[model samples]
Target: MPEMNRQITLAQRPYGVPKDSDFKLVETDVPEPEAGELLIRNEYMSVDPYMRGRMNDRKSYAPGIEIGAVIVGATVGQVIESNHPGFQSGDTVQASLGWQTHGVTNGDGARKIDSSLAPISTSLGVLGMPGLTAYFGLLDVTNPVAGETVVVSAASGAVGSVVGQIAKINGCRVVGTAGSDEKVRYVLDDLGFDGAFNYKTSIDYEASLSELCPDGIDVYFDNVGGPVTDAVFPLFNLWGRMAVCGQISQYNATEPPVGPRLFWHCITKRLRIQGLLVSDWADQHDQALREMAQWVTSGQIKYREDVVEGIENAPEAFMGLLRGDHIGKRVVKIG
Candidate 1:
């Protein structure tokens, strides 16, 4: 016998773009299950650019959140009741618990969350998906061959910031682009990117890219698409590699931004452009976390967090992410 709970759901299927009205906050009786399931109260949830794509009624790497249904998200929580053998009432776990206050699990998808070793919230940021995304997306995809030149857009974001630093660690010359002068300096000075530029200050994406990457680019980790992507195309060295990560510039757009006028350059260079969702590499999450954590503890890697105060402000924090308002990993605190 237990008390039920309420959760939030999608208010509407976004048309072209999402609005705050598209999300519906609702209350419902807590879910109870037959057997081999666990019920828990979620603590913290992560807000990511990829979540924006889920708002639209379209097929993607994962199913989109349906209208009047709870929005999907990654959450860390503690089990309060359990009939499952693997989980107990006090067990801490991380899973796709969604944008609600509570959730029930079959005990299949949930993974143990260890707060004793590191901050529990890190499961959603540095030590979790974002970390793995930056790792595999940059190292595995781009290769960042030693002494080569690497450039990443959205240089100071969760994944971008880590990607640039890792590239430097691998002995590649790295440059990055950000929205503000402060972010530019953070990547260049703090993160040790060989160079950094503020894209907002220079409208001509090609000119800016040319100035910063005069040696040409061997690896291009594309975080934002549109004009920056177009600018990066011509600078690609022969057989250059491009990893198409989250495209925040066009995430809120009613339509995808158009650019890349230099498709011919790609053909001539025989460049390889690949798109990957970090979830696709879930199998490697643990390995990446272990190595990343070691680097972080030793000062070989650095992380920055842009934290929003409360759960109620999750939407505003998400909005800031789309507008490039955050300088690093963005998270919201919930109690």
Candidate 2:
């Protein structure tokens, strides 16, 4: 008898916000690697805001998850069987193996993990896509300079947390927005942001930004769009740069969101706003990873993880992430 494999598959395309019923867990025989392929036993799998977008049927940067397909996500795994020259049975690797306990891959899009540098899970968080997202989004896209005021939304999250710390490292006065007071404290105290506010309580985002960013926002790292962005626009300094990363605020909108039109701020303030995907800087990933690893290992950059145990709980974990129930990088530990 072969070992059993468990997977979470997309059961239905979400109409708005996803529900547990939208996902189905299925069991199958663990697959054997063919020649030139590797068999992986996934240890940690990521659940992120972008996965919400993928649950819809519309095509974006990546294709939508099809019904019954294993939900797409980054995974940290150990190679259990390998016929590929680049991998060995004992090697730990990071791959887009989705929401599964076992996967077989051709070694494409898979990278070996150096567990000595950091925990294997960081490969899915700080040193992985989220960290790189923060790195290139802030530095490459926005080019935040020293002495500037940098504000990041979702500041306690995987990407935004790193964004704030990196901005601080660059000598910028960093401000962050999170959902709760506890998250705000984590951002300000633990992550070293100069200022942070709970957006949920800060009913007037403009007032919050006005108080925190007295010099005006020079660089805006936007993770949650909508009202928060509307408020930030008015506070943009001349020649400000905005990195539009994720719009978790509008990811689950049943209808297109209507808000104040603020493009005039772009004209008057000469603001530069651009959307970003981590893969946009694929050519620079190795360099970024090396730098991020050093920062993380040396305590220059701090990270927190919200790990949910068991593959069976992945759906609930993902839903909780969407609801802002987790404080940091939300991942599922598959046993």
Best TM-score goes to which candidate?
Answer: 2
Error of 1 at 169 (Å): 1.7
Off by over 4 Å in 1: 1-6
Q: Write the per-residue lDDT of candidate 2 for residues 1-335, one digit (tens) a residue.
A: 66799999999898887888899999988999999999999999999999998888886888999999999999999999999999999999999999999999998889999988888999999999999999999999999999999999999999999999999999999999999999999998898999989989887999989999998999999999989889999999999999999999999999998899999999999999999998888888999999998899899999999999999999999989989998889899997
TM-score of 1: 0.93
Per-residue lDDT tens digits of candidate 1, residues 63-132?
Answer: 8887788777888888888988888889888878887667888976688887776777777877778888
The global C-alpha lDDT for each of the candidates, from Candidate 1 onward, is 0.82, 0.93
In terms of lDDT, model 1 sits at: 0.82
TM-score of each: 0.93, 0.99
lDDT of 2 at 66: 91
Q: Report the Cα lDDT for residue 179, model 1.
A: 90
